[model samples]
Target: MEIEIFTLCDHAQDFNGKLVIVGTFDSISSSVYPFTHAACSLAGRLRFSEKESGVHEFKIKLIDEEGIELYPAIEGNIDVSKSVANYSTINFAINLGNLEFKKPGKYAIELYIDNEWQKGLPINVIKQ
Candidate 1:
């Protein structure tokens, strides 16, 4: 089971710039996806910094070709502080093998930040 983790940096920081955001994940299984990459626009990417103040919201959903899969189970909001000026770490406990998939294939899971709509990265699950 893999729970893909993403980051929400400041909207004024450079791509290579370092920043921090309070990250949290609620998972269906104890297994979790690894922290992947950050999703943002070219402008958003270059402007994101850890030294910003505000409460950013993030959401996750599991879906498939038929449509939405897992319902909203976990929801939380983290406050991003520019004072930290460094990357903070968080983790989600998930059990991937327990998920009831409509079919054995790739599943669509999404992650959201700051009440903005975002797509979930692809995750492969093999039924044993």
Candidate 2:
């Protein structure tokens, strides 16, 4: 399997086989200690192995600069049924529910597939 595109955006939607995304960014500023990302979306395209048709696990995590987890890991099972297509679309609305930054620094959004680390999206935070 391979990833074609991955992004963190202000808005994303699947409109009749189309992926629509807006306001893709990596940095945010906050005036409070616990910074809450009120709304955001993660969207990407993935190519899967055609050898089998079954269920696979997809997980995501948010980690702070200190290596501390900002929130609990999010995971779900992806159903790859009998299909002839090799590519699939994925979209997730990530709402961390008022996550505490602890301190201002760089953070990361990690993606995992089948328990294996796939990719990471770097995030920076600044205090206002």
Candidate 3:
């Protein structure tokens, strides 16, 4: 399996196998210690080869610089079917609401597939 696209965005959706993403960002600015983002989305597209077809477990986690979890991990299973092409692509968009940042610092959005770490997306919360 391969990650074709992974990002944090203001909005995202999977429209009939197409990924529509808007306002992709990696940083947030705030003037307070604890700031809440009202809404956002974690979007991605994963490609699976014929040999990798089947049920796959996936997890998404948000962790602060100190390695503390900011929220509960999102977990789910994806079923990949064998396609006539060399690979099949899966698009996903996870909507998040009221995401709180306790402090200004760096954070990571991590993705795991089949219990193996796949990618880490860095985000910075800066005090204004």
lDDT of 3 by residue, 1-128 (tens): 88999999999999998899999999999998789999999999999999999999999999999878889999999999999998899999999999999889999999999999999999999999
| Predictions in order: lDDT | 0.42, 0.76, 0.95
Summarize candidate 2's per-residue lDDT along 17-105 as a digit string, tens digits. Answer: 57787888998888887766777777776666666457889888889877677777888988866565754444445434445676678
Clashing pairs in 3: none
Candidate topping lDDT: 3
Over 1-128, each residue of candidate 1 has an lDDT whose tens digit, in order, gives: 12233432222233244423333232222233432223321111112345435566656666665656565644576565455545433343332333454334565566656666565555454343
- Model 2 vs. true fold: TM: 0.82
Off by over 4 Å in 3: none
Runs in model 1 lying further than 4 Å from the true structure: 1-48, 84-97, 125-128
* Steric collisions counted per model: 22, 0, 0
- Name the TM-score of candidate 3: 0.98
lDDT of 2 at 60: 87
